[model samples]
Target chain A: EAGVTQSPTHLIKTRGQQATLRCSPISGHTSVYWYQQALGLGLQFLLWYDEGEERNRGNFPPRFSGRQFPNYSSELNVNALELEDSALYLCASSLAFGTNLPDTQYFGPGTRLTVL
Target chain B: SQKIEQNSEALNIQEGKTATLTCNYTNYSPAYLQWYRQDPGRGPVFLLLIRENEKEKRKERLKVTFDTTLKQSLFHITASQPADSATYLCALVRPGGKLTFGQGTILTVHP
Candidate 1:
């Protein structure tokens, strides 16, 4: 089966601009997760969507938002981007909850977002 | 608040030796722990997953030990090779599937 896939390998945006990154999860997966990895930093969870509903979010501000489509693909939107918003945005997917098994997330290559 | 920490410094070791990485966490009781390997400019690949009840799990040359009492997990790569060089990350999974990750440790194996 194909793994998770991301689009626009890289994105360039200026301060005050908006950026959209997309991801398609593996087949049969229903949970999509978004994470941001800043330069020299670890992956920080941004949002979690399962079954097309926002389940949970991280400490990030509201400007970091995303949604999951019926097909379980997801799109991350960064509004009013700042210079610090430049980082690698990653998307992952896993089996939905209550599967009675561990939900091991498979990640996409990620989109490199650069805000000038 | 939950916090996961890994050695930020890069680890260098000769090939054919065992490479051990550490991950320590606090303020959360995770249902399970996972390890991932990430190459530069690439996404992380799942390496292993150890549940809280599992003390040790192994896959080929990779071994992972989870100590819930100490709130720590140790990842080991035996007979390491240059190809094993990458950043290894440890993530703690909450009950609802939220994963909190550590800073990751960079490992370099000399051939």
Candidate 2:
């Protein structure tokens, strides 16, 4: 089975620009998560979507947003990008919502966004 | 609010020895604590997941111990090798079912 797959393995954008990164979750997986892995920031959760609905989000700003599709694919959008936004944007997939059974997340290779 | 913490410093140990990493948390309880291994320029790979009620779980040479009392989890890699050198991350299941990660601890196994 294809693990979670993300588009644009690497991205480069200038300040004030907008960036869109995409993700396709594993087959039959209904939950997709987005995380930002910046230098010194480790990995921080940005959003969690289940069955195409926004379930939860992290402390990230409004500029950091994303949406999930019916097929469990997701896209993360960062607007008015800043230099600090240059980091690895990872997308993960899990089973259905509210199910904690071995609720481990399977991640994609990630989109490395570099905002200049 | 719940906070998870790991050693920000890098750990260096000789090969063939056991490498132990720690993850500590404060405030509420977690349903399960998970361990992940991440290489440079790569996404994190799931290592092990131990539930709150479970004391210890092992897979191959890797072992994870969860102590809900201490609100901590310990990850161990026995007979460590140079290939085991990477950053190990710890995560806790949040109230809404999201996984909250801590700052990973980089482990370097000297040959």
Candidate 3:
């Protein structure tokens, strides 16, 4: 089966500009999560979407937001991008929530966002 | 606040040896813990998951041990090979569906 896929392998944007990243979950998966990994840093949670609803989000600012579509695809929008916003944005997908079994998340290669 | 920590330094070991990595957490009671492998410029791939009730889990050459009392997890690779070289990440899944990840431990196996 194909794993989660993300578009725009690399993106370059200037300060104060906006950037959009997209992710398509694996087939039959319903939950999509967004994370940011800065250079020499760990994965920082950004947002979680399930069944077209925003279930949770991380400590990021309001300028960082995203939405999940009906087909379970997701889009992450970063507004007013700053130099600190440069990082690899990762997307992961898992089975529907509330299941008895543990939900193992599968991730995509990620989009490298470079903010100048 | 919740915090997860993994060894920031990279580990170097010769092939055919055992590689052990550690993950520690603070201020969080997770229901399940998971390990993932990630190479440079690539996303993480799930490896193993151990629940609070289970003390240990194994898959092929990989073994994971979870200690609830200490709030830590240990991942081991037996007879490690150069192919095992990568950043191993530990993640904690809370009561809800949220998952928090550690900084990751970089393991380099030499021949």
Against the native complex, each candidate's DockQ, computed on alpha carbons, is 0.66, 0.65, 0.64
Model 1 per-residue lDDT tens digits across residues A3-46: 99999899998999999999999999998999999999999999
On residues B5-108, what C-alpha lDDT tens digit does candidate 2 reach at each position? 99665899999999999999999888889999999888999999988889999999999999988888999999999999999999999557868888999999
Listing every candidate in turn, what is its Cα RMSD in Å to the true structure after a full C-alpha superposition? 1.3, 1.3, 1.4
Model 3 earns a TM-score of 0.97
On a 0 to 1 TM-score scale, where does candidate 1 land against the true structure?
0.97
Worst 10 residues of 1 chain A by lDDT: A93-102
TM-score of each: 0.97, 0.96, 0.97
Report the poorest 10 consecutive residues by lDDT, candidate 3 chain B: B1-10
lDDT of each: 0.92, 0.90, 0.93
Model 1: TM-score, first chain:
0.96
- The full ranking of all candidates by DockQ, starting with the best, is 1, 2, 3
What is the Cα root-mean-square deviation between model 3 and the actual structure?
1.4
Task: Name model 1 segments beyond 4 Å from true.
Answer: A99-102
Error of 3 at B22 (Å): 0.9
Model 3, native contacts kept: 0.64
Estimate, for each residue in A1-116, the C-alpha lDDT of model 3 and write its tens digit: 89899999999999999999999999999999999999999999999898998988899999999999999999999999999999999999999977533389999999999998
Instruction: State the iRMSD of every prediction, in order shown.
Output: 2.0, 2.1, 2.2
